[model samples]
Target: MHKKETNLSHSKLANNMMNYINKNIDTDINIDAIAVEYGLSKFHFHRIFKEQIGKNIYETIKSIRLQKASNLLITNKYSTITEIASMCGYSSQTSFIRAFKNRFEQTPTLWRNGGYKEYSNNILHNSISSDVSHTSFSHLEAKIIKTKRKKLYYIRHQGYNKELSKVWQKMMAWVYTNNIENYEQIAIYHDNPIITLQEDCHYIACVKVDDKTKLTNTNLPYFEIEEHLCAAFEVEGIYGDILKFIQWVYHYWLPSSGFETTTFPSFSVFEKNHFLNDDGIFKVIYYVPVRYV
Candidate 1:
């Protein structure tokens, strides 16, 4: 194979491994099983995954499990703290709570009760705007179309403190396994309007579900999309890097584009077949609600 083809094959392998790990969060997954799934030797898989994803495979599993447990706690009215802890692979309730608190800066109960606050005070949160010199707007073409309302299975992520990688893995895994795979557009909607330029900005990881009525069967949280006017911007390469594009839109695009920003929290849209774009290159479609002032 040519060098580029070899590179693509490796990328595909890495993505497949990620998806497999996500799908089996509830199962007894170890390094050997995961490495073998991708046809890579254990040592090589460990090294490659770490270099590519910036985390070892074991760390990825643990992080994802914790995130799923946290989601189950806040969104499910029927779930108790103990049950949530056990489901996420934690052996003891105290250990679960400690890990949860360390990640979210609030207890599970506080998060469930809505005691956690979204990141506010933009200037305070982002003090280094002067350091970034890329104020020149990327002349992105805008296309407007009315989309039908979508039923979403969503869990509110409370507190601006936890890593969302695990939460994302679990949510996507559930969606992929369930019959709701048809509704493939995934989104993370934040209740907090302010973008603090961090991964922990309080938000909801959501997938369009069959109906809000079936949300109970999946053991996941749920919400429905309300119709609204949205301004969309597509950013290529690593959705985690959306803060910079958001900064550009809020500070530069909105003002010059003759569009007024809404107070509502914007959402990031993940389209199906996005992996096919530029050969599994990551991208994010940021949806900012807009209106004429």
Candidate 2:
């Protein structure tokens, strides 16, 4: 195979492994089994994955599982420690707590009872950097469109502190450190803060990349964004007001425009200087997955 095809193949395999781990997060995973499923020898799989993903396969699995459990805890979905432990695939609650503490430096209960603030602030909680009250959507262009698939490289953030200022700061620093200024910066909201509890909301500070871009060395979790038919809108507002505009699209614009939301989550594509700008206002295009009713 040529150099380009080889790179693409390795990237595809890495992505597949990530998806498999996420799907089986609540179950005991076997590295040998994963190697077999991906049609590679266990030793070979281990080496390439570590090189391309920047973490051992099992290490990545634990990280993802912990992040998921953290989300479940803040959301208050499971009532008891035992339940959360079992749900996260721990055979014993004590073992789960030990592992959780080892990774996050806090017990499960402490982490859930507003203890997450030590690691995360509620920057995403009921805050606005600029007002959009006078902003007019009439001047912006919006329409329904189908988006293509995209592979996103992102750093996972937990709790309510998706504060764009801090989030972007870390992202940009990482970029400069790694010297990857060519990639596209994008943010992914994993849960709806409006409906989900404030502490349970998840966000990722991300950039778009292709097969040619090295991922594992970047030290961020990567995922694929599936193609979707969506109701797209262009708006200019403070970074914090993104949710506000989404509410506008869902509650008013979508309903009146004869479209219903699809199952996929919505996302925004930001313009230059729109995110974390000096004026605190961002130019963005929002995409809410939708279907014609």
Candidate 3:
């Protein structure tokens, strides 16, 4: 294979590994088993993963697990510390508390009981302006809906900033090149920007695809957006507006709504993409996967 093809192959494998880990986060994940599943020797798989992802496999898994735990701590207040630990795959609450404190510098109980605000405020100080408050979307009503599963061709992006325009540009180029039409543009927010550092947020730029679509030559990965029960809200906003809206959904509306968020990441279906437009405005239907508390 050409050098570019080899790189693409590595990226595809890394994406597969990430998806697998996330889906099975609550279960025991064996690295050797993953290597076997990918038909590669353990050493080879680790090398490829580190080279492409800039972090060793173990580090990636630990980071993802902790991030999931952090999200759960804030979103699922009713679940006890022991339950949250079990949900995040820790063998025991003692072990989970040790790891969580090592990573977050706070115990699970403190993080759940408002310590996260301090952590978030420290990270978001320079990124999000103080004036951008969740009040912007306070009046918007959320509807409960069931969404069908969707197939997406996506490019993973790391940051949630204006630089995302480049990712959207690349996605559009891929769509036009593949002759894909009648597709909806969607973005999956894998991290809560309020809690995660802005530069480290996981964002996916995706285009919804159907059975008829064909990719003659492309290396982009495909992800199936599982069917979800969600609280859907229509939002129209500028750069900071969507961030504020997400904050509102998680902090304001969710706790009192009699629902707990699911482990699935929240996503938005774009009616107009702010990144691609000159005016920097967006129209989207934001979906937060949820279930009754």
lDDT for each of the candidates?
0.57, 0.65, 0.84
Question: Candidate 1, residues 54-106: lDDT per residue as tens digits?
Answer: 67788766766665654444344455788767666677889878987876678
TM-score winner between 1 and 2, please give it: 2
lDDT per residue for candidate 3 within 247-270, as digits (tens), equals 778876887788888668899999
User: How would you encode candidate 2's per-residue C-alpha lDDT over 139-178 as one tens digit per residue?
Assistant: 5456879999888776555544435568778777777776
> Ten residues in a row with the worst lDDT in model 3?
127-136
TM-score of candidate 3 versus the correct structure, residues matched by position = 0.95
Tell me how candidate 2 scores on lDDT: 0.65
Clash pairs (backbone) in predicted model 3: none
Model 2 misplaced stretches (Cα beyond 4 Å): 1-141, 159-162, 197-199, 214-216, 273-275
- The TM-score measured for candidate 2 stands at 0.53
Candidate 2: minimum summed lDDT over ten consecutive residues — where?
Answer: 123-132
Alpha-carbon TM-score of each model against the true structure: 0.47, 0.53, 0.95
